[model samples]
Target: MSDAILSPDQTARALPYSALAQEIATLLQDPTVAVPPRIVQALQGGGSLFVMPAADAQVAITKLISFIPGNAERGLPTIQGDIVVFDVQTGQRVALLDGPTVTARRTAAVSLLAAQQLAPRRDGPMLIVGAGVQGRSHLEAFHQGLGVQEVWVASRSRASADALVAHAHSMGLQARRVDEPNAALADCPLVVSTTPAQQVVLTARPRSDAFVAAVGAFTPRMVEWSAEVCQHLARTGTLVVDTRDADHEAGDLLQAGLDVSTLPSLADVVGQTVAWQNAHRPADGPVFFKSCGWGGWDLAAARCLERTRAQQG
Candidate 1:
């Protein structure tokens, strides 16, 4: 067997964001499907490297994502890498995807799917709490998936927030920059947090019926929501997680003094227990979705991209 390779340019021509989001949503509906597990290797410079390999019936894909916290000062991206798709049965290489773009699209799509399931069906203002790649991607996803009327960008750096607002407006979105996170929360019922802060930052909890998606913290030491917020989510709304074990190991719930046993898995939500649990229960607070960015989602998205390429060819 030989190694097969497809470059970033080829991936762009093959898989666009619109198609990727639809395929990802379809893949998430099936619980019988399998997702690849992630393997982490520690680097010498206090950074970590990840190799995620996954496949379904049609094709398999492997992604390599590297994280170096100190790269920002050097004008480099903190998260960088590439994705390779392959023929699952023959082990032939199919395509190579831009990791950052793929990650951004898939992450936002996952959140959008969760929102569709949990949030009320209405078009209104939305808030994004980070101004980096993930933050920008969330804006695109919300536009594509939810058709939001207005967008509010909020970041620690005022300039960054203003820049994102400018970008959004250029894309024909009604957007503005907000200096305070609470202001953003107050204005929008839907909020997405994409920061890498070590402690809670959002000043106030989201509205009682609001939906908040937190995808920034992948480690135990990093958290974007406060303990009070997590407690509110656990008590009132449906908290959906990608993996129960993973969330138990590294989520705001654990840090907020809540037992892992108390939370529900995304599987539960897909199975329709979340709604029942919510209806039969008391008012706890806001609904929350915490995603650590699963490799299975990458595999699913990569597989969809591969299929699109094949059909186009």
Candidate 2:
């Protein structure tokens, strides 16, 4: 059989946010999925080559992406590559999927799953800090998965913010571009930060019932929220990480001096007893889910694509 090379749009359609989130939730509870630590090769001028690999019972996938920070000025995406998935039993290549789309959608799906399990309010106003690919995908995820109706987009470039707002409007959501994301924090129950994490983008404290996801800053050197704000949330709310790897890569939590070992990871939530959840989770505080990238999510996306193909055939 010829290997399928899926365009970004095709890849995205196969792994819808709702279906992708459900796949991730299952993999989180399934112990057989093996996601090893990703390897990073340093490049000249602050670029990086990332090789992320993962496998489960049926499939194995490796994602190759080049992170060229200078690409922004060159009018190119900083991350570019594709995920190559193969059948584990036959050792044959099955599909090649766009990496950026997989990354954006799966990351948003991680946040979507966390929001479903933790957020006190799902269908309320949401604030997206950094209106880029991530912001756009997340707007679709929350809107489709959790029924978010209103959205506010913020970015350093007014044009970028407006683009995301317009994209949201195109999706039939009530959307607006905002100058200050923090100013709207009090009114939004959902907040997601997807900036480059060069500096802090949001400083204000979120409401007690809010569900805020801090994504896009994966390395120790990158940070999105002020240390004070992170610490405030840590002290006053529940902190859950997307995976165990966040203990090392979650700069937002690490820079705030919070011990990541004590936090509940997404993997811990799916199969736990109600008593375990009640004992570990806070009764009345915000939920701060720090999402660093994970290869396991990519594996889940591959599984979703495989299932989509099977259903179609």
Candidate 3:
């Protein structure tokens, strides 16, 4: 069989947010799914490289990503990489997928899953912080997965924020640029932050019963939320994390000084080990989710994309 190469556009087309989120939920529960710890290697000069590998019964996937902070100044995406999918039984490469696209879609799906499980369903404005790739994907996720019609985008760059709003409008979503970050947080019931800023970008007090998904700031040294958000989680709602390893890499959780073991993992909810569906949360509190990027999601999304391409062919 000939190996297929999937471009970023193809990759994005293959996985609709709602379907992708459903597949991810099933993958998380499948006992056959296996993910090894991601390997991070420092480059000789400046940036870093990450290799994530995962496998199930039928296929395996490996995603290689290079992080170059200086790429932004060069007008290039900071993340550059690809995902390779292999047929486990034949040990042959079956397809190649765009890495950053997989990352953005899967990450947003995971965040949507967490939000659905932890927070109550309501109709209100959804807030997206950061106008990067992840931010754009998450806007689609909330809109597709939860039927969020109203959206607010917050970014340090006015142009970037406006661009995101335009994209949202193209998708038939009611989106607007939020100049006041604080006001956006307070008004939106669903908030997702995809910025990579080291300092706190959101200082506003979120409304009680809001759902907050922090997608960026994966490293222990980087943070996105102020201490106020942390304190709110500690006092009122449950803090859900993608994996326990996030305790080491998620600065949002680490800096908040929360007990890692005490927090519930998203896997438990997906696996139905916890009574997540019927679980009652505080009526006037916030449910927070912090993702540290999982390798298993990469493999599952790659497999899904391959299936999609095959059907299209």
TM-score quality measure for candidate 3: 0.93
lDDT of 1 by residue, 80-152 (tens): 9998877778877866678877787788877877777777533658889989888988887778777876888
Q: Report RMSD (Å) for each prediction in the order shown.
A: 2.9, 1.5, 2.1
Lowest lDDT block of 10, candidate 2: 273-282
Q: What's the CA error at residue 281 for candidate 1, in Å?
A: 6.1
Ranking by lDDT: 2, 3, 1
TM-score of each: 0.88, 0.96, 0.93
Best by TM-score: 2
Task: Give per-residue CA lDDT, model 2, range 1-313, as digits (tens).
Answer: 3489999889989999999999999898777899999998999899889999999988999999998867877989988999999999899999999999999999999999999988988867899998888988899999999999999988998999999988888889999988888898998999999998888878899999999989978988789999999989888888888888999989988988988877878877766745337534567889899999899999999999988998998
Residue 235 local lDDT, model 1? 70
Residues 1-313, model 3: lDDT tens digits: 3587989998889888877788788888788988988898878765779999999998899999997766766899989999999989899998898988888899999998887776665466888899888889898888888888988998988988999999999999888998887777778888889886568988776777688888878878779988767877768876777887787888877887866666667887777666454444556678788898889888779767766777778
Could you give me the TM-score of model 2 versus the true structure?
0.96
Question: Candidate 2, after superposition: displacement of residue 51 in Å?
Answer: 0.6
Cα misplacement distance, residue 15 of candidate 1 (Å): 3.9
| Candidate 1 Cα outliers beyond 4 Å, as residue runs | 1-13, 29-32, 271-285
